[model samples]
Target: MCTFRMASNSNQMPRLDLHKDSKKLSRAQLDYMRIIEQQNLERVRRLAKQRSNNIMVGCLLGFGVLGIYGYSIYSVKQEKFLDELD
Candidate 1:
């Protein structure tokens, strides 16, 4: 018997399993399942790549902001020290 189940996550693809009799599935059914699986695999890969890129961009922005903040603090302290010398 061929059984199809929905994944726990609604965003994910359905899960298909062949149970009891492997030979019972028709050629068309097998072909359809194969196509769906391939599509899902491609979607997963694309999503993963996008997520990695987002993280990289976020980290770069965070570092840039921190650098700017640190530089401003250092400049303020330097000015204060120079003022005290005069």
Candidate 2:
């Protein structure tokens, strides 16, 4: 178990003065933000693709295992019936 304590000032958070004559962002800032956002989006897409691929691989493996098990059962039954006829 874990416990957390809140500070007294946490209730009354300080407000940011956005219009306090802040410095303007140069073209470099925009370019940097664009690149960061692009990379983040790419990462998300890659993760989604990997998840789908993993799911597909798992399904294929499950079917393969089931097929092998079913074939073994069928072959055993067939051999038993043939032996009985003999």
Candidate 3:
């Protein structure tokens, strides 16, 4: 019986084998790492939500400006202020 000390599969994708450290780490370290990962995930979600809100506000503001501009154009067309000179 023998071993090549490496995977013999040619089509298999190689990946990081961090499970080796699982046995070496104590409970406290594992818990701390889990907490850090969770915090990072939460921070990412918060930033994503804020970004969506900002985009929504910006879109509403832009539409408001466009609507006002359109109304001004319509009002100007309805009046004969410029036509009086012609």
Highest lDDT among the candidates is held by which one? 3
Query: How many clashes (backbone N, Cα, C below 3 Å) per candidate?
Result: 0, 0, 0
Question: What does the lDDT come to for candidate 1?
Answer: 0.88
* Colliding residue pairs in candidate 3: none
- Which ranges of candidate 2 are over 4 A from the true structure? 1-24, 81-86
Q: Considering summed lDDT, which 10 consecutive residues are worst modelled in model 1?
A: 13-22
Please rank every candidate by lDDT, starting with the best: 3, 1, 2
Ranking by TM-score: 3, 1, 2
Q: What is the C-alpha lDDT profile of model 3 across 1-86, one tens digit per residue?
A: 88668757989865535586578668998899889999999999999999999999999999999999999999988997888898
Give the lDDT of residue 38 in candidate 1.
100
Model 1 residue pairs with clashes: none
lDDT of 2 by residue, 1-86 (tens): 99999667856956534356235555776688679999999999999999999999999999999999999999887776666787
Whichever of 1 and 3 has more lDDT, that candidate is 3
Clashes of 1: 0
Best by TM-score: 3
TM-score of each: 0.68, 0.63, 0.71
